[model samples]
Target: MHLIDLRTLQQFVRVAESESISRAAQALHISASPLSRTILNLEARIGFALFDRVGRSLRLNNAGRELLVNARALLRDNERLMLDLQRRAGGTGGTVVLGHMPGALYNGIIPDTARRVQAAHPSIRFQFESALESEQLEELRRGRFDLAVQTQDVSDPALASRVFASERYVLLMPRDHPLATTAEISLNALVEAEWVVTPERAGPSLRSAFTAACRRQGFEPRVACVAGDIVSALALVAHGFGLCVAQESLVRFSGEQILVRALPLLEMQTVYRIVWRVDGLTPAATRFLEALAAPSKAATPRGQRKR
Candidate 1:
């Protein structure tokens, strides 16, 4: 029987991503000769040339593209299987995979609920991933993530969501900022300020909302920088980089250097929801969901600041 080794598949995928065997080898900390030999062996076993040599570059053929997709799926399955086996061997309760939107941790509700579940079920394993709402939704649909937490509404009928927590939005800026002196900053007043926002991968929902709010104030927002997450965006604001809209719970980080101001005209409420598929859930996920159903207190999760 012919079989593909996980290691070989790994190298193949790495090469496919890097588009160069040498670069893949360097990234994997291995020699190029062996890596090239492994790819050739894989091509032979698969009865097709996976790569076409274009001068010095290795370009994926149609077969290679298809194989890469299946390879990734197989690797994900292998990882999940290995983790399940490890959990069983360790006498653990079970494993729960959770994904949440960027800056969901800033409000502390998701992590707090997670902590409660972990405390009650010490034997169970909890896997957490922080990503954009779109990424979380895609992963949830793919069965990669068991649950997701985000402020945006999930439009899919297959997924079910309920309000988990709510917080008002506040403008965050440097204490020395001209607008910091105001008791409450108006949306129109912020038209001229450079804004820092989360990266595009964070989804367009919030950005669109901010834009609409600005437009309603008769001016387009001037974005200065795009950060990886709301936390990072707020950090940039704290360092006098630009301004960001933060949740009311984030006020604890002001520290006399950053200022928090409410916007009455653009009063925005952040509504967080715990989303999961309508299909069956593992006992561990069910328990976690049950715990998460309650009105989450603003308790900070472990390793998170009280924001």
Candidate 2:
């Protein structure tokens, strides 16, 4: 529905990327003046000044920076549309890009999830990347990635998610700690213990939750180490460096020295979910999600599972 021409948009992108009209013109095999005119024409069409020009030097203004993202997305979608057409005409397999946080790969969760999806849709292949939640959401919005699988949710209305699994958080520590032998322990008892938790930027507000739980127990957690991910946090715990609170799902990666214990007082839970843009999903993405949507066996009751 946009009125701007693709050619003009491409020219604007080239100029914006090069930061010089002459350079972009040379790269595009055209004279600088016409290329500059194309940019002006685009600005006119969009009704905004995209660049700040001072004595032949060009810098992207705020409007330009904002437009650049959408422009690049348009160009990318155009490329993807062509590929889609070609793939459809040939009756071949399609590709979907998946973004996830780090812990998924550590315990082989993402692969297991993909295999579960692939069981029903064998023709759809997946590509994966580990990225921050913000970056994952941005790329998913931009059509760079088709879906995101993470433990955290964002407030953006354009994105939607389905719960894949919910795993209760547990404390990870070496086997020989004094309270480690205890069947149950509270956060207050561990307040004096050194702990390892993920930094805020890496994933969810895990450390914040842990700290809040500690505060409710009348003290803040002593974070001896801030790990980049749950895997590294567990690794630190295995080496007897400190205790770590992690998801029960991570028990798959636990070593002989590592013990997973439920924390009654932290009162935390994490859900692994599949997130996608609610609009404009490609066939591959939709099909993969539909496969994932198939119902699973009923969950066992906590009382029965323990027995």
Residue pairs with clashing backbones, model 2? none
Task: Name the Cα RMSD for model 2.
Answer: 14.2
TM-score of model 2 vs. true structure: 0.63
Q: Candidate 2: deviation at residue 14, Å?
A: 42
TM-score on alpha carbons, each prediction: 0.63, 0.63
lDDT per residue as tens, model 2, 1-307: 4588788888989999999999999999999999978888778877889999987778999999998999999999999889767764443347789998766554444565567656765666789998877788889999899899777666789988877766677777888877778766754568778888888654466776677777777887787888877778878888887898876656766777887776777778767788998896777677667656655442211211110
Segments of candidate 1 deviating more than 4 angstroms = 1-92, 183-188, 299-307
Pairs of residues clashing in candidate 1:
none
Off by over 4 Å in 2: 1-92, 105-110, 152-154, 297-307
Per-prediction RMSD in angstroms? 15.5, 14.2
Candidate that scores best on lDDT: 1
